[model samples]
Target: MSTTTREAAGRCPRCGAAVHGDGRFVVWCAACDWNVDPAPPDEDRGRPARVRRALARRHGEHLLAETTDGGAPGPRRDPAALAAYAIALLVHGVTVVLAVGGTWFLVTGWGRPLMAVGLFLLALAWTLRPRPHRPPEDGTPILARADAPELYALIDEVAGVVGTRGADLVVVDAGVNASVTTCGVRGRRLLTLGLPLWEILTPQQRIALLGHEFGHYSNGDARHGRVLATAYRSLTTWRYYFAPAPDPSLLDLLVNLLSLPPRAVVHGVLALLDQLTLRATRRAEYLADSAAARAGSTEAAVGLMDRLLVADSAMTTLRREGNAAQVVRRGTEAGDRADGLWERLVADTESIPEGEYERQRRVGALRGHSVDSTHPPTHLRRARLLSATPVPAAVAMTGGRARAIAAELAATRRTVARHIVRHGFPG
Candidate 1:
């Protein structure tokens, strides 16, 4: 379902190694890293995107340098982090002011119009209020502790290694990624494990993934905290409400012109937040990777990075399989075609050669691919894991336990396969 073509290119200018490309991707030396961070594509050529990229690169470089110099990442009180918290508080303060003003108008209004104004203000306050994160109601299965005790036991062991609580819920979905986040007002931990990614990982790499997620909690990642995170979300919601409509009508243009000042203020606050938290968040990721290394050994953590580097390939394989089922529908039901999709995806991902991994690493360097903009570059993460002091795995998995976990997930895998068949894999 997945294929690659390769041909020799010129020698690397830096290392004299024979460079190669498929004529479709970048050609670069995997040995000495020449042309790896070439000029990025035109899609990100906008001034705002360029600025974000520059800030991200600077943050990553500085943090990587600090860690390489033997600095261990812990919660540090920096002015930037303080400023970020201040701005977040200021945003929440605005919502509170709106609520108070609305309530005052409602209670003391002398006339109907004043009461209507109060109602409008209250609506605005509600719209701008900070919200806690919640799990999506998209029918993705959520497994409780009793449903998968052995799997929960494994996660609990990894959580202990990372000095955090195990997930309260295990969510399965048709994705090629995994993450841990808190949900709802109580800050309940939830592990959203992507079946496609889980299927391809070795038992140890799975431990590393869990460790990296739990590390977010142990390392005090501000983005995972409701206070700052909800503030960011509130600001984003404000920005969205003020954003100019695409293909604007005259009325829309008038609204945009009238709202320009507040919009500018919101944009400025958002930019300030990004600047303040950029360094802290990026460092949190590096520290989380360290936790992964501590939990599952440096080798497994680095292997996890390699798998992430080629995640696009895994998704492509899923897309191909899904597409094949549709294109070759020879009187077969969707369920018939969806059967064993996860198995095929696992096979395809495992069949990737070591050479392909190298190419992807180079490509990741070239494109500055990361889990997201909040994260440092994948190349940097992999490099840090390799350069950091190695630690033996604190949590090891036996074959029997691994099989039991798989058995627990078997029904969920079937559900995910059906969802993928109907919706295809998410991009």
Candidate 2:
């Protein structure tokens, strides 16, 4: 979940201890692990319109509750949001223009040597901008195109259906999610599939999940991702270079104190960009969810989201016990028993909340994401899907056959296993 005021808001209802958050969701009492209910409020069930969704998708969480029943969201032509975003980007453009123009004036018009130092600062910021090296797999298993024709073919057909560009790489990561991203200096497009996430879903649900990622591509979110990523990297790099120096001694402290004003100026600009982009980020998620509903069955899309709630907890439990390497090793070992692998993942995920604390954990995971969250809360996303009036498409697949397909990726799984053992598990 996105960070919320609930972390320090009040006492836990069950235990009455000072409440603390586990970050995404599940505020708890450190003494007893008791928690407040995290589910969407039942009293407010008004259907959300598009403009309202776009608005709620911003920092205001309660705005989602102001919906009228069965009101479909509007088209992407959200003038207010678009205008806000334009204004933000325009602000960024103006900064660039002023910097460039000022630098030119300092260098040519006024030949003042010391004043010309400002141009050097602008040049330094540009030179300090980041360059990409490689796309991160984050310990995700890789499936080569040549080795897995069946999986590649499925991805290809799905991309064609969604009318988006096909991915050059398929990554099997450990999560209850899937996504599309561009990485590497060449900006290679990647399609990431959470392998264990796939195990929890029916074939149709899997299709809907994949469709969700492709939806981002079709809606231009994926393309925008690379651009924003470059900007973020550049900002971070510049911030690091301009930030206060480390204080190991009195001399270092004095240097940082002297540099405070310049650091504050740089930080102010960074914060401004973050504030402006928050709404658009949430809008992108809403749009992608709608695209998923249109490309696949709404039922399947909803089911996939429901599964994700539980899967987050399951992945944590599965990995935290030092079983990440074991899971991958076992996946590669299962030949005809691939169904057993799927069953194991599903059973553990479902059984995560046996104890009181665990139950609290589950409920907490179900709550909404934080303000300025990349994706909206699960309930909000589900509500949007339910409220959307787009035509749903039917998908065909055999469960047993799909299991066989998953089984066939043993070699790639083993490759990931070797990498994990060599570098230590990511978790």
RMSD over all Cα atoms, model 2 = 9.6
Off by over 4 Å in 2: 1-34, 37-127, 130-133, 136-140, 246-248, 320-343, 352-372, 389-391, 399-404, 414-425
Q: Give candidate 2's whole-model lDDT.
A: 0.57
Clash pairs, candidate 2, are 1-24, 2-369, 2-370, 50-73, 50-74, 135-184
Top candidate by TM-score: 1
Report the Cα RMSD per candidate. Answer: 3.4, 9.6
Please list the C-alpha lDDT of all candidates, in the order they appear.
0.81, 0.57
Q: Model 2 reaches what TM-score against the true structure?
A: 0.65
Q: Each candidate's TM vs. the true structure?
A: 0.89, 0.65
lDDT of 2 by residue, 325-395 (tens): 44555446334233244454566565443243444434534544422245666666676677656456644
Backbone clash total for model 2 is: 6
